[model samples]
Target chain A: MYLVEKLGEKTIELFHSIFEIVQFLLLIFLHLVNPKSYNPAMRMVLTKQIYFTAIGIIPIFILMAIIFGSVVIGVVIYLSTAYSLESEIGSIIITFVVDEFAPFFTALLISLRSGAAINTEIAVMSVNKELNTLKEYKIDIIDYLFLPRIISGIISVTSLSFLFALIMLGSGYLFTFFYMDMDFNTYKYLLLNAIELRDILTLIFKSFAFGFVIMLIPIYSGLKTQNHYTAIPVSVLNGMVRLFVAVFFIEVLSLIIQFF
Target chain B: MCENIALIKAVHENMSISEANTLAVEMLSMIGLQKIAYKRVENCSKDELLLVMFIRALMTKEKSVILKLPSEIIGGLFHIENILKDMRKVNTSKEIFVCDLVSSKAYYKECECHIEESN
Candidate 1:
């Protein structure tokens, strides 16, 4: 009976969180289409958020992508060659790197870096009552704060996922050239023949979904913080954990959709 | 400093940045603190903070302004008159009310503004 009660409590808590997220998502989407939400201050914040989330991380992101991409692509090539399944190499790379790994990996890196920062920033702002100051002045928080961050998250993930995929493909060629004695034309022809419009669409859709939740979850969790300084860290921790879970959940859902 | 003061008007009223900025500077000059126009909040003295808060209060569309516990912002009973003088220099027509403790009533004795004491 005690175990049943605990399970019921946990289940109710989960639904409550989901209901809150959906409500917040609806609120954001409504403001997103409202012309007035993109006032001068919001435009300024959007530009700053894009610069901070996407541009600032580019140099480091590129280096990490090259290092990580080379290893993953190199292993894919090496394993295919060892099994004498080199004819299937293009399809394998397309399936693993293009359709799945790139977007998933990019989302994880961004959630770790920018997601945590945003969560903490919002949490601190809430505790300090800076948001209250905005409220008293009739400035909309959704327009001024939440929308810009969420929009930037979507832009960053979609663009960076494509960038990551490109770098990985480039690194794939290097591995095939030096280690597998494959030429550039053969590799290019292989990938082109294996690629399809659907694969590209899936990548785009998956990135958009991933990006939306990454920022949305954190901002929601941050706002859930109690009106105390001690609540800030707890809010961030919960936000980050929820962010990772949402990332994996999206990835799995995409996989299921692809299967059907 | 100017952005903080102009933010509400700029955001709420959809006023252009330059227009809001111009208004903020004019308000600062009215209070004789135009030189600190670009200074950050932390760099300003207590009196500057109080004056800036006063300007922000005026930025709202409301006709009357309330200064709840002015001593908390300006830091003492001794400087209340000077703060009141700074408030009067600004060209706003908004009515200003100074709410303070009965014990601090002596501090505003020399000022021309009206004071209401609450039990």
Candidate 2:
């Protein structure tokens, strides 16, 4: 029984990878061709994703960022005051908010919002032959469904992350100013020239790629649906798994590219 | 039948009608171009499939193939020429284990026209 379960799991994983490859390529094709096949469906998907993902996360993200920021500031001040690194307070806040936390949080929030939702929706759509029917109707599926989501996901993720990062930075700075009483100008001096153009570019690139991959993997898996309704949940489940895997791999790759 | 012969003759020099359509559809599928539809697979002459495939390929790649389509008997011959260029790159990528599927003969002659048009 143990050996049989292992074999079954391995086979499923293998097939999942195969289907994902095919689906991603197909979507890429649809993307490049700018299919006008399904405008209404595309718009609907976009509207729904925006409302569910971008709308639902704002308050929660802000609150989480505040708590994380305050705690980090408390630690920074405690250590920096003792070590004579008080002047580096601003740099610490900026790095924590921008470099490490912002992107990861943005990706996480967006993943929860768009990744899970799109994967399930597409998987369901696929099992129903909805995608195939659109094709049969000669409606351009790319232009309608996928592209809109891509655009919306990028915008939504970017906007929300920027908001959360700002809140965290502000909260951290407030702690530094009030409790630590670090000189504000010294803190500014620490960070103003510290940010390189490359770092900014890396941040944008990382966020964009995160948004892209999150949407890409799930939708790709969803489109591979065979005509069985069970396949819907199964594909979505597989997509969720792949989405996390891609996110992890991309994060590592981005760090390597940015630093090395 | 003379009509079938005429249709086949009209298709082009080498590929039969069915071969070209299947080849065109298969090639499109191979390249991950799902949105590019194959409407009315039959009744296209080789020349027509040649024109259609060329147009479709160019469009799929987001190249401007519209003006070139009416330029010659082969219409957008530039489309096929570009495919040939990509095919040459495939040879180089093959050594690195990357599959260069786009550089195939689907662009060499519009078999789509020959097959589908003939059908």
Candidate 3:
């Protein structure tokens, strides 16, 4: 019941959904292959790209990481110290905050802000014929507009997630020392012991994929749309739902791939 | 025939032509229009006009709603006459509609979507 057969065709459409997933990968590849096609105002694209994904997300991502990190550190430190398992503190911080929570949380925050903006902005452009107008002016709309967004999104999500992960680690450290018997050196030792090259790679991939899926899905939905002023809202809603699903899907899939 | 007309009347009974147009587009599927395309007497190029016909076409559960549309629709023909020609060309599906009306004729309704039914 999740999907109604439009024109008696829901199952096949789901199959076609895979193509939608590949559209961004294709865009990125094409852009790289034909760099000359996008030679108009490359500076503007880069600036807007960074500004949208990185700068706009700094304040909120920092705040969330700080608060969430503090609470987590406080709880973990208290529990570990109380149970005399304080040595396990570093593993908990590395596994829970760094590997799992911080990256996902940062990705979610960036996704919601940047993803919604991409989706809604593209939809409005589609509605207002701005996309059409771009074509009229001999601009490669996808090359300049969407390609930069995709690139910046991946870069920003990875970097920003890394930054917030550090912030969370610091916050965790603060809570442990001030609120528990743990010293700064003990906390630092715990964290350093948990560091592994694979963990960082996993975190980076997850962040980038999350950001990529979020923005790409919306772009697909906006382009596939035909006039239903009503359909714009529906497309956006569908995009958001699919985005969250994709995020969770990546988490599970990555875990499987790593295990194998 | 009677069932189709009844459905149309029911679709248009208390609604304005514009309202009927919206209902027409919403109701028709691509297949439904394909099976009955040539029989369509009116070809609606304007989305507003096609929308009313589409709403009327789909409002009824009756299988023959497209074949007999007179009963469901009422007296707005005088004002909506320009659009009636396009109605004749409709195939009763979303493909042609999207190609002809939804994609080409889509204009942001600058005004409140108005619909009046004359029950």
Q: Number of clashes in every candidate structure? A: 0, 20, 38
Give me the displacement of residue A51 in model 2, in angstroms: 4.4
lDDT digits (tens) for residues B1-119 of candidate 3 = 11221234332243433444344433343213332322333443333434444444444444543322331333233333333344444554332222112221223133122322232
- Write the residue-wise lDDT of candidate 2 on B89-114 in tens digits: 32121211111123332453642222
For candidate 2, the TM-score is 0.57
Candidate 3 segments whose C-alpha is farther than 4 A from its true place = A1-8, A37-40, A81-84, A258-260, B1-119
lDDT of each: 0.89, 0.61, 0.63
DockQ of each: 0.70, 0.01, 0.01
Candidate 1 per-residue lDDT over residues A1-260, each given as its tens digit: 99999999999999997787788889999999999898877877888998998899999989988889889999998899899988999988988888998899989988998899999999988998989988987889999999999999999999999999999998889988999888999999999999888888988999999889889988998898999999989999999998998999999899999997
CAPRI level of candidate 1? medium
Model 3, span A75-187: residue lDDT tens: 87788778987677777678777678877887788768888778777887788776884564345677656777777778888888889889999988778767775788877
lDDT of 1 by residue, B6-90 (tens): 7778787888777888899999999899988899977999999889988998999999998888888767979788889989999
lDDT preference between candidates 2 and 3, better one: 3
In model 3, state the lDDT of residue B30: 29
Candidate with the greatest lDDT versus the true structure: 1
Real A-B contacts recovered, model 1: 0.67
Give per-model TM-scores: 0.92, 0.57, 0.63
